[model samples]
Target: MNKIRNGSTVVLLVAVSTIMAIFIACGGETIREVEVVKIVEKEVPVEVIKEVPVDKVVKEVVTEYITETVTETVIEIEEVEVIKEVPKPVQVEIEKLVIVTPTPGPKVEETWVPTGTFVGVSNETYTMSGYAPDCVYCATMVHLGVQESLFGTKRGDAGELVLDPWAVSSWETASDFSYTDFKARENVPFHRGFGDMDANDIVWYFNSINPLTNPDSRNDTGGQMGGTLLETSVVDDSTARFHWDAFAGHTLFKTFTDLEEGMGIFSKKAYDERGEDWIKDNMIGTGPFQLVEWIEAERVEMDAVTNHWRKTPYVNRVEILFVPENATRRAMLETTQAYAGNLPIKDWQSMFDMGFGLAPESIYTVTQIAMSGNYWEYSHIKTGDTLERVRDISKPHVGDPYEGGGTTFDGNTPSMQQSLKVRQALSRTIDRETINDVILGGLGEEHHLGYVWNNDPIWQENADAWSLPYDPDGGKALLTEAGYPDGFDIEWYVGTGDYETQQAVAADWLSKLDVNVTFDRQDYSSWRPTIVARTNSDIFGGCCWGPLLWPFEWTSNTSSFPGGYGIGMELPQSKASFNIKNGSQDQAELKAAAVDMLQYLNDWALFPGVVQQPNAAMYNPDMISWQEMRPYLWMRLGGMRSFEYIQLK
Candidate 1:
């Protein structure tokens, strides 16, 4: 039966090449038989028989297979267009103005010799009058290499602050931190024939400088160390024991080793023989440099000590010229008359464009507004003397424990609560971002939470809660709520450092709240005595002095010293500071206490931070190739240290 439709066709094709070859081998003349079938349009089939050659059949079969394969593989693809929306282009303008004309620096010599006089122009004067070890400006003498402490600060392998032994060789503290025995290095000679340094000299040095032991002593650091430093005794010629009521070894380390506030060890022989008045004008220390003369408001000349015990100065002589004018200092550097000068931040790029050398990086220093006169302590910690608290309850930013004759740091007190609000208002009124960008030239970052760094663990956790926003309206509301609807007058003290411009900006912001701010601009040396005495109740525009009560990773209280340069800040967290100074060995406990104190500071806004800026160095490339030596914690703006290792190019 045949089942083939009219439209549908079924075709069968077979290839029998092997059978054809067999038949051909049998007889080349033999004829091959073939069959053919035909079907009509209807369901009718017809059959026909035909004969074909084997070659013809094979050719026909191959042709049909190729045609069938080609018919099955025909496919057509359609093309479509895709439309996408394009965003509008934004136009940006770029200005490429030259700051200064490029100039070649001084030519370098083929043979280098580190034996020239280095003249450095500084914006600040050396001191107001005296060279006393306890003076705030005494650190300048130590930084200039004319004096050294028993211990000094240096950069560790990780660029961390480490203690560098100078006069002292080794130390051992009691288990309870009651006392520390320091072994002094022998044969350390003093300048101008003062004789060798000994344990007796160390004992005399600490006792005489401390106001607690010597009532006539005028050292400001007496307030910081006097409470804990009970006595100093000589064990032998090279050993001295410092007895403490309570001591934190780290706090002692920070206070004793600091370059800014540390007591510069002077010769006891000179002090005894020459008297206090002679010692005040003269400097005698076991340092690499010996002071030749200091002309007031002019220059301080020093000659390098040959074969110094600690370090031999590369330069033969050093001259520190007091150049208050920024332009004059820059001019001196450009003319090659000054090896180094403290220039302004705005001029740094221009100076570099003119072939000047800068430091590898800048040292960071925090600037804060110390809301001074927060007298919360009822009595003195050591002497049990009746301490006077803030009497003026009307002062906007002053906290008084004696408010309404109150006897405690009661937060519920009217004056205390009002002062807190005023502080918060002042902090919020500040435009730190704008000030950092404009005044600091982007070299500073917004700083808050007192002395804590931006990325510190405590700051990271509490940043959201602790950070005060820039809200002028909010500040006004706070001031109004604090009973200052018409605002108030504040006497803001500005000392040395890069603070004037920033303070001016802050004052402008403050004016919006009807706050009349009066700035008292004076030399820091003159202001030092008042600040140390805690006599002024006015606010200061600077970092807090003394070791920070907070346990920072760097362990540098001076880095962000609380209490506003040792102002009389008696608060509820005052005992925390006492413990830190007393020498608590427990790190975790200390950190907790520090964090608690920071919280208190933040909530009350007593000591609010503005921004942290860089203290950079700029020098002539030809005069110096390398200027770094030991670590310098806090120096003035554009100030350079470690003069002994300055390499001449």
Candidate 2:
């Protein structure tokens, strides 16, 4: 018998032989020569079998037969004795083994080397005003690295809102949330030979932009300031304190850090010497770029600051040209004449197909219909007696637009605007799907509520109840029931750009409901002042006002409330907003107040939202690299691209 072990298996071979006795006594000698042969085989006894323990950590010896190589060798245990039988001989062959070890993974090296000149084009021209830009387009110059505020706010890598240290090093709020103290960074130099920025510069900048302090200063962004900033006091050369009238500490800080409305800190000496006219044409600030030449309504050229305190500009220079024609901008990008440009949705796919980078961002801009409830023609006669009652009950506790001598709809006779049924009927006449698909080229979200984002939890929860179903027949019936059986004539004012096309499409859909509409196409420059001054007494169709940068601003008296500086729509939700602001800071109380305000706005439908359009821009990826674009408090300004972080690939 013989035994051999291979890997996990053990084999045993056994041989047996049978012997027959000779019949004759004389054959006894011959029988002694009996031959042995194999007959039967049997397994070894259980008691004689050696047991191999399971789950034991044993080194495996692998042998390669092809080249007779020993792949692995385990010398832990010595060879055991082999069992043998003399009946026959058996041959055994051995294979050589070789050992092999795994190699480590490849290493990855990543780096971003910044260099080159960045050139971009814009559809709108920059006004380059002294205090505030006439148009929002001029504000993009600050984002282009020419100017910076005391503090900067942006979405961090983790998607949370973060206030980054810029001119301001650190800050803290008061216990009552009425004020915030900011410590300015030291040794931050201003461009164009202005001395370093300090607490004095901070105080001067805010006061210059504040309408209360500098009445001569043209602050188009004053509306977004929320009328909360009372004063800015210089505590010392390195620190400053911002005081507010109400408990608006958080909002006040946000307003200072906001990319659009927030005033950029300027050199007090420069302004005092050069004056407002010179400051308009020339910019001096603590930024990564210095303005070289700014040709009003034509082009702007800036040179990069090589040794900036915060971050040096990667590009040597930045040139922004005003190409109002979309086709011209598109051609520039295609020909590589411009590194980046504002792209229309219709041209986005084509640009992307051509290997250009496409950055699409969600802006605070929404296109909606602003029905002037204050118009005597639309006034609700039935509610004329209750106008005073509504005004008294819904007046806000703070931030009253009427305080600034701004007229509200409170004194207007309540007419059709007071009827919820009429508003709902008018809302139903709008074909949001058609506008989103046709006019916007499928680059928009259908919104149900005004001012509030559709994705917000408050709106999401009550969207169904707030949304008006698109039913022209039902709308016609409702209109007839509201005493306009044959439809009423409305003077529809449509501004230039997307608004012109959108309102035209909407007017077509509204005609199906027997609504008589006359379209008045006007340029944005002319239309903006009219809307801002509340001179558009008739139905003014335009894009929704830019996003109220802060959530609290959404409830500010200037935005959603009547008897306040409203955006044409006279909604009676000011009391709710005021109550929420003055109410207990308790989470539950605030949430309840917010919910009540949202419910009131939804029921009123003061401004019927159409669609939230996406803002898109095209760039050359080979020349530039950037993170995801953000609205950065401005819809038209290409998501506030931080020129400091943008690297040239």
Candidate 3:
């Protein structure tokens, strides 16, 4: 400490007070440091001093203020950043492991191998050889694809009927319906190394089958085409023209295009060189198959022609086995000896339950009773000449106009009225519904008239009038009114096929009316000739017909003409209706005529239909697959119609 003087300067020291600066930052945030620098001056209190200078004491007192030096303190603030730390993830590698299993091989015994041979079992093939056109069983050759026809019928995709040119390329009909010219397809090779077919071959075929050219010809085609076909002339190498007296509507399709009626075209050179005897057992035609061997009733073997122009058979060879017994046929199918077989209607369900496929509904034929010896036509229609007609009035169902001198309903003879009542009684006694269920296994429809299917518009419209009710009492009363109070004896000509069973069913039903029925069993080969010649005196109990591409009225309805199974007899009203169907071009007029014809046929009750039978068969689905097969719908009486469409798995 220094003493204070009046004229001296004073130096002072001071204690400093410091102020601290604080910084705040949120979590995970960066902080900025703030540096504080300050310089401050502070005032200090000083004591009063009296000063006495040298050599003199001053009487006067004086007060003076003194200035002081003070030291300053500096506070500096530095900015520092604070950052939150984050941890990094770590990755580790590990070894991989795998597991394996073994597989077993298949055994050879479990595999199936194709034998390359397909067998089809049928009830019968009467003539293994298609020797002549007149042969009733010869038409099957054309259906089997061993021969070819000039024209053929098929069902279109929409199930409508379609007539196609088979061997011929194209055809042109005369505007007056008098002639038709056809151009044969080129490069059509005949089977068995025979020369190719041409216009000359076609001319020769027609001439050979016609009675006018060959007087010895006994073919039924002579009666169908004798009066209509005048001649066939060759125009060029592949063109031929047919001259006709009058080519009516559907005449070509119904006669020439029909599988049953159409004659399979043959090679002229083969006939000229091989002779009749040699050609009888051999077939020379343009088809997709070639005949290998025929063992009569045993079997018919044929080999497929590879890469055929039309269609090639899927199997290398086909064997059609004739198994007469239905049980044997079924057994053959079950044992896999036969891939397909014709089975009875009753066995169809059991076979189907065993995974067998049934025949498609489209391929079916109608079975009925066609009364023979009912010839009522007094004159020939084609010649318009008085004819010597046979009227066997001894049969109760037969009518004789010669006795009463009239032939129409307005002036019907007594015999005609009596025959009508008797036939009606026979028809009424049949329980068609029961027969359809029991005999046909409910797979058939109960039909009332021939050539009139249940689906036909005419049949649908006239179902009530056309249908004959099943009334045993009414039948008895009708028989009593017809002067047959005691039932008479009648013979039913039976044949091999489903018709045999159908006739049996009908005869059993007829027995309820006190009618004594007798059976005249015969093979179709012997029975067909008499019917074709219109000489059969007994009623054929089983008559089968099919759906034609067009309405056919000339076959059974024609007067003194060879036609279908029912052609054994002819009627006057039916003959008149035949003319209408042949002459009229309008569909409406033809349908009207058909309705009238069917009505007359129904009222006469001569040809009473029993059931619309399906040409059904059984097949093993696992062994054979017809998945994409479109069968030929016009196969009448059913054989292997579309056998070419079969495929083996």
Candidate 4:
């Protein structure tokens, strides 16, 4: 039966092929040849196919062909049968195709080569501490040309404080803010061929100043500034990561970016070979300028670095002379003996009238009567005690109840200056408006709070609550209630500049409360250490300023006046507020906490803010032109003035 079925299938296939061939042969007159293709069926099992290997298959097919001509056509039909074995499946591997293109390198801009010299005069002199800057002013001088920091803060185009890349190219904080990684730009050279900057150099510089790494080198600025940094890890030749136990908010940025007192990256090669003593006297940095000569308190001379990575200075040389006298500094600018010089507020009107260039913005410097909140040193009296004292003592001379009594508080007893009433009394005595208008020659702002600028959003939000009204009567009443029936004798320490005059004006108002004032005049050099150590007398007057956008930077007990120099002597309220602000993850809550802290400081009367000091520099416009100056954290020196930006007109 199977053989019969197979024979019938073969016959059907042959018949179909023969018909297809005949159709092709008759279809065209053009002499064409036709062939029927093979058709295979595996249903039939022939004797040869059945014996085939298991790895292969056998098939049967039939075929036919025909030919035709134009003149005489010949048709032929044929049938053929064949069987073949199919190969088994095999495994193969394929690879994905990819196309790659090379990236173009960055275009290098031409550096500005300076040809002329720029002469500048200032009231202060450089400390000549190359690796370690002693003061903000000295640090600024180093920043001018001799040293460069990893980052710096500058005013953005939108007038907001923004982080600026300097030595480093980019930085990123970890997801949890535990660490920040930084990448150094390629080919950033160090001054005097100390070698190019790399991650190792950065790690060395950070470790050199970090107290955690080198406890013996506990310099004031380095210790306080690098307090938050835990460890620095070198990720690669060009990358470094700084780890912190906890995030310190904006201060973490400020420590590396602050124009003044920020960590300045030094050359690791130079330090190792040159030694610390040599480094202190000499400067090596990748800044726009190189130190040519430093004559201690006389002068400091610097020459431009023609191929500075960031900018080449406009002037070839900068000669900074130590002219402590305000008049000398003014004369230097007027005669073009120097192109620019520091100007006192008393000289502002005269300089402006003479058509000299005056800085367009106010500096962060605030000249205030800093009262000691050192609870350990002074006896603290409470508001209740003051009220009790007021009840016990009758009002002797009463034009206004706020006016102090004729009798003095007990000299034998240690009195509290930290009392809110005492601070209020002291704040009320000095009229800030008069100070701004008269003593400052209408050149300053009447500031009544600490750590907050009048233009700050935080200040704007809580302006009404922060305002300290001038009330001499109220001041006297508070003082009288605080048991200072007349007034107390307090030593007033002051440095040079307008502070002397401002303090004298304050003394006059303070005397109205029968407060005896003993003036201790000292040169700033002699007075600074005492003030920074918190060893200065009852009242010390100086300029203080910080980043306005970050209120906690100045208010934090761990920073600025209260923390760094023991200005408020570790006030518990400030520390608590600082902790809350630092630990808070929400920005709004942090800001609110900062403002609250500032309000608390104000209430505590840690330092009664008198006025925001005006910073002025006189320059001859015909000889030089300067871009707009931004509000600097260090008001004494204008905001990070780059000689690269300054040009000869």
Candidate 5:
């Protein structure tokens, strides 16, 4: 019984010990798998190996050893450390900055050589290359601004400015005559009565008046005077006109007088009026000097009218002699024939050798082809012929010249300008760029067919699409479709006065296409007739005109292009209204196409542009104070001769 009991206790002890060992092993492995862990082995409790203390004896021993046992029960412990590798973070940086703005650039600069002190007319505005351009043009510069000097502080103050006005028969008949509305009148000639309103005596130059009484009634002799006085009358017998000197093709002279003496001159009316006389012997304008003498093409002598006006014009006596040629002027300058005069372009180079004051301004003009009601119509040649056929047709239609009347068109005629496809074909066939480079010295730009300039907002902004590239292939296709697959003959008419280079350009352009073009240069009279006949039918080739801003001013069959295009038919087509309304070129879907075929060219083409011609004034060094000023923009009151600033060496 004792052995069995002993065996049972042993079994129980072994079982308990095995269970504790398993628990310890499981806990340690779990920690190691998930973390950096450490395992330590120490002794198990001593009581497990020893027998239990007796109740009475244990109590007595506990009391005796309690103090000592309690003191030694505490154990010492040390900490374990673990380390693992992980990723680090990153860093960054930055940069510097700056800013800028925009502004206008400077104008072009030029250098010139002069033979003498620059002594040319100072005028700037006459329809040419300046800030402010004009509608009219003249041979010589209109004013003295070309010399780059100010006659006074005021602009357009032509206070006896030296001008080269042509010897004209009458202002009313000739466009060459320069006249302003002095008589405060509408469509009336300027009046310069022989009277003094201001301090000085008013001696005015007058343009002829409109026909009120018969020209024969312009008799100053009145009742008596006959014989020598009647015989010397300007027109037949006598004259009541005030501008006798200018009218007589000579200088005029007069003094102020309240009462009428022989035949007193009349005053002129203001602008926009029926015609009122407003002339005074002496007048005050914004000028430093006043006209002391009224010399026609002779010398415009001015006296010191004001403080500043009298300061310069430094030379004591100023005289202007009319000699148009450059060689003559240069020769005079070289030999020092005159104190001041215009010099040749070559002689300008020699002036640098002597060291004299000089200044030069570009005095070029804008070439405008002014188109009027006179032109050919659709009734002329139909759109299906060769160049020869048209030339032959153009033969008999030439009109008379401008000197008189001889070339009036017959009531029955047709127009050749009616076909847009033909014109487009012509445009494509010609290489305008090549012409400009070769003939115009690369100074001109290639142009399209239009009314306004592409750069001008007035024409361009208002225009529709049309200014596309010259598509020769497209033109050819169009020509073929228009029943001219074989092309037709055209007599490209040339005028007598035309520049030779332009003729070459036209020939070259025609050569590119399938046509036989011929040239026939005629005199002014014959040319005039040809123009009228051509407008009436296919008598002459195309006419190239001067620079004009609006395309319509130069291109239309009647005059000027209206920005868009339309098909012109002898009879109206059913599609006319629909195409015009529904085919809004500005619409989104067709905007690009319209822009190319219509608007662009109508405002930027050859018919209207190249407004300013390339012209420059040759000058020497001493004339230092010259700031290129725009004549149109600057000249508000008068013509181009007015100037505000100038410096002389």
Candidate 6:
């Protein structure tokens, strides 16, 4: 082996000279490499399509149709070289054997060709025939492409887009046409634009985006409702797809998006001209049902999307009529009056056993507390001379493991979180294992600070210091040192109907420390104004995480937030959170550091972590299959056995 003797050799030679002169030496790590899988990027479905039947070609179960686009942030990794040399190739003699296997050919069935018919407003412009309230969230499911502008509607309602409204407005005016002009055009003929379809064929919307185009104004960037609510569609014929709006998540989706977009967007959503509660109460959505009635926190009725492309859906439509009594919704599903939906966890099993379908979808959200200084950089703050340290005091050496589940947060504020002593004390006081096993009945999963599963590569490479260890003694010492010798009451914030196991365990453990919390919120909207909007306190508590992008979300407590030295780190920080939209990775280091710190806190219980809650749904074998799916507002129900796809059979 030969060593390079140039720029790379300076430190080595200096080290040798120093060692010889004073008998001084140090240790170093041998760089180990990781093996990688070759990803053969092969281009890798649901719903009923009007196709030739397997036997005859005529069973056209055309329910009518629709429309579709995407922005995927590219994740490219730079490979690192290891010091160890790779083994040279080894060769061996080959042996030949006679083949006993036969080439099997085919069991063939009659073919059925599927097709889609386009519906809703076609043409390049915003096409609307009759007047109907539009639900942005539900509108995203279409296979067609559409463009709406910022000037037409405001954020006070969930009608605007994700991009800048002013930017959108400027472009629209430049086009010499407003959304109204585009809306005036004649609707175009439907065509299965998305390409290749079937019943039970799963079609997806671009997370609040639709494919309906306004070619006349396609170049106009002034503005359009680029996201949130979406339009839905289905395969109509070999050449057509039907469309409508799937109305479920728009209300909440817009609320969260506004929060994520920062104060400006939040302000638009709340106090803006249209106003926040307007969207909340008006409850506009484009689904099989329309909000025909609302009684203020009471009930809602819906009518089917008219001329919804083809034969209408089954069930004669739906109604989430006010049933304040939790028991009412449960009874409705159990008795088959409401059809199907998710019920509270308490009623989950009973409904399942009784044969009602469980909404097998991603539902449970988590909240966890964690530290920032697990790494040398952030740890220095916690180990500093000043009373405030970055690392939690209880178990300074606790290893933070990554690749798992759950998120880490410092309540919702930093000043309250800006102290390591308090965070560390809280971390040590609770027992994660007990909570995981007993409280959660192991129903949920534990993750590294960023809520990444232990299987994730990031957790493997970086967060070795965040895995939690149960140690009340370690926690007590931290609390006592933090001036909470007798323990103090800290309010815990969470969503309603979150994991009960976590709350119970937290109460049990903190109670032992003479520390207690009253309760937490079940929904972000209820808790957001005070915790985030008001942004006044440091002692905020709650959890939120999802996808590979939790670090991308600002509210997450992980130091991974690129904006500021995360509150948990106890570093000098800004009083407010930073906005990092446009999917920017500019602050990646800060994000990585944030993740490191968050996980580090987890290892020592810096934040109380609950279990990972997968969006779950239960369905009767006789009715539907509750298969698992990606975390989002998506579910499949279009096969022949599907309710919408139902037949006399």
RMSD, one per candidate, in order? 36.2, 31.8, 49.4, 36.2, 46.3, 22.2
- TM-score, each model? 0.76, 0.69, 0.76, 0.71, 0.35, 0.45
TM for candidate 3 is: 0.76
Q: lDDT for every model? A: 0.57, 0.50, 0.58, 0.52, 0.25, 0.28
Error of 6 at 119 (Å): 27
User: In lDDT terms, how accurate is model 4?
Assistant: 0.52
Order candidates by lDDT, high to low.
Answer: 3, 1, 4, 2, 6, 5
Candidate 4, residues 297-356: lDDT per residue as tens digits? 566678888867766778788877767676777777788898887775656556656888
Clashes of each: 8, 13, 5, 7, 88, 115
Q: What overall lDDT, based on C-alpha atoms, would model 2 receive against the true structure?
A: 0.50
As a TM-score, model 5 comes out at 0.35
lDDT of model 3 at position 158? 35
Per-residue CA lDDT of model 5 for 483-602, tens digit only, reads 566666554433322233335434543445454444444322223332322332332323221112111112223211111111111111111221221212122222233233334234
- List residue ranges in candidate 6 displaced over 4 A: 1-288, 309-312, 321-332, 343-360, 369-418, 447-455, 460-464, 495-499, 520-527, 536-543, 549-551, 555-608, 619-649
lDDT of 2 by residue, 503-529 (tens): 443464456655555555443333445
Per-residue lDDT of model 1, residues 55-90, tens digit only: 111100010101011111111211111111112111
Candidate 2: TM-score?
A: 0.69
lDDT of 1 at 479: 91
Tens digit per residue, CA lDDT, model 3, 319-438: 887676888888999999998877766676677668997543224456667777777677776676765666787889887766755544332778878988988888888778766666
